[model samples]
Target: TGGSNAFAAPEAFQTRSSSRPSPPPRPDLSSLASSAAPEQHAVSSVPEQKAATEAGVLPLYKIALCCLLTDLKINCRDSLLVSRAQAPSLPGYLDLVEALQQRVAAAAELKDVAALCSVFSGFLRNSLLPSSCSPDVQVRLLHALAEVGLDQRRE
Candidate 1:
C-alpha cells in the first residue's frame, strides 16, 4: 500500500500552534502606593457617618420608617393610629416609630404641611417595605399606594 502508516514514530510528534495572544504585563501598583498623596488617602478614608452627615442624607432605616408613618397617616387617619401602638413589635421598630412620631408632632406643631409633605415624599422615594410588617400595615400601605396613584392621575 502506498498510504502512510497511521501510527507514526514518537520522534515524529510536533507541538500544536496556540491561537491565544501573550498576556499583557502586570501593572506596577507598588509605585502607585509610594506616590499616592496623604490628601488622597484622607479623602478616601473619610468615615461613612461623617460623609453621610456632610451630604445631608438620613440613615436608610429611618427614611423607610418615615415613609411608613406617612403612609399610615394617609390611609389610617380615621383610626387615629398611634405610631407606637401601630408599630410592629420587632427589633429597631420602637426607635424608628418614636423618631417618626416626634417628627410628625414637630411638623404639626409648626403648622408646616408643605414641609411635612416634602419630607414624606423624600422618604417614600427612598423607602423599602420591611418584610416584618404586619398584614394590617401591609394592607394600609396598599391603600396608600392606590391613593398616591389616584392623586398622580388627577394631576
Candidate 2:
C-alpha cells in the first residue's frame, strides 16, 4: 500500500507531456520591420497629450466644493432629488477646503486676489466661529466657500 501510494516521480510528469506537439516557431523579425517613425511622432505628441490630460482633471477640491455647494443649493431651491445626498464627510470636506485654499494661495498673488480670498476666509470663519455646529451651518458655509472660488473667475 505504501509503495502504491508513493507520489509520482518528477521525470514522470515531464515525460508524460512529450507526446504533445511542440509550439510553432516564432515569426521572422526581418520581414516585420517597417519604415514608419512611430517614435518621432510619439515624441512630438507628448506635450500636447500631457496638456490634454491636465485639462481633463479639474482640481479635486474644486469638484468636491462644487458638489457640496450644489447639495446646499438644491436643498435651498427646493429640488428634492439632489438635496437628498448624504452630507459631505466632515474630515474629507475640511481637508478638501484646506487643500483648495493652499493651492489657490500658492498659485495666485494673494494681495491682488484679496476680495476673492475674503469670501473663502469668511466661509471658513463661519464654519469655525459658530457656537453650535449643525449640518445647516456647514451647508451655508460651503456655499460661501464655493462662491469664493467662483468669484476668482471674474477677476
Candidate 3:
C-alpha cells in the first residue's frame, strides 16, 4: 500500500447530482446560433391574399394540399406532424391543423392528377429542394419544373 502515494481529496468534494443522467444534446445549426434574428421578408398583402385564395379553391387547394402531403411523406413517414396523438373534444382546439390535413387528404382525386403532379413538383423545387440539399440539385429541380410549365423559382 505504501508503493503509491494517497493524496486524494475527501468525499466532501463530490456533487449530489453526479449520479443523475445528463440531458439530451441540442442540435447544431451552422451560422444560425447568433442572438440576432433572421431578417423577415416583407410580403405584399394583396398578392398573399390572392395566392391564398388560389390555393384555397377546390381544384388548386386540392393540388396544393396533395403536393404538400406528398413532399412531407418523407419527414412524416414515422408520424403525422399535424395530427395529434392525444386529442380532446374541445371546440376549435385543433381546427386549423385538422382542416389543413383534411384538405390535403381530400385532394387525391383522379381528375386533377396533372395539377397534383405540378403542385408536387413546384413544392419540391422551391420549398423542399433548397437549403436541405445542395444548390446544384435545387437548380436541376427548378429546370425540370420549368420545362413542365411549373415555375419553381420564387417571384
Candidate 4:
C-alpha cells in the first residue's frame, strides 16, 4: 500500500470540501412519477387520504369507550391504548356526537323501532357506549314509550 494513513476514509462519500459534505442530489421526480404505477399517483393526489395515511389517531371506538367508561365512573386511564398524541380534540367530538344524536332522533321520529332497538342493544352490548343505568328496565320503558309515541299526533 502507498504511504497513506489506513485510518483515513477513502472518498466513499461525495463532499463539497475536505471537511464539509455536500447535500445529496435530488431524485428525478418526473422519472419517479413516470415509473410509478398510475394508482400510486392517484392515491397521493387526494390530500385528505394522504394526510390521514401519513398521520393517524386511534379508532373512534377507543375514544368512545374511554368517554363511556369515564362517564360510568370507571377508571381506565391505566389501561388506555391511545396516547395524548392520538386523542382527538373535544370540539371535533362535539360534531360527531351531534351527528349521532340527530341520527337517533331521526330513527325515533320515523318510528324505526328496529333502528332504535339496535342502538339500545348497542348501549348494553357494545363497549363503545356502555352505561350503568338499568339497561333491561330502561329498554322495556323505552319500548313502551315508543309504542305510546306511535299513538300520538304529529305537532
Q: lDDT winner among the candidates?
A: 2
Task: For residues 33-99, write the lDDT of model 3, one tens digit per residue.
Answer: 6665555533469967776665656576455554554443343322232233332222332343244
Cα-based RMSD of candidate 2:
22.0
Winner on lDDT between 3 and 4 is 3
| lDDT preference between candidates 1 and 2, better one | 2
Question: Cα lDDT of model 4 overall?
Answer: 0.37
Candidate 2: worst-modelled 10 consecutive residues by lDDT: 1-10
Better of 1 and 4 by TM-score: 1
How high is the CA lDDT of each candidate model? Answer: 0.42, 0.45, 0.40, 0.37
Compose the digit string of candidate 2's lDDT tens values, residues 4-47: 31112235434655667999999997588677787743454776
- Collision pairs in model 4: none
Model 2 lDDT at residue 34: 78
Q: Write the per-residue lDDT of candidate 4 for residues 8-79, one digit (tens) a residue.
A: 222432232345666899998777666667776674457676556433422333344335434422332222
Residue by residue across 35-54, what tens digits does model 1's lDDT show? 56777655444576566564
Model 2 clash number: 0
Residue 78 deviation, candidate 4, in Å?
14
Q: Candidate 3 — which residues are off by over 4 angstroms?
A: 1-129, 150-155
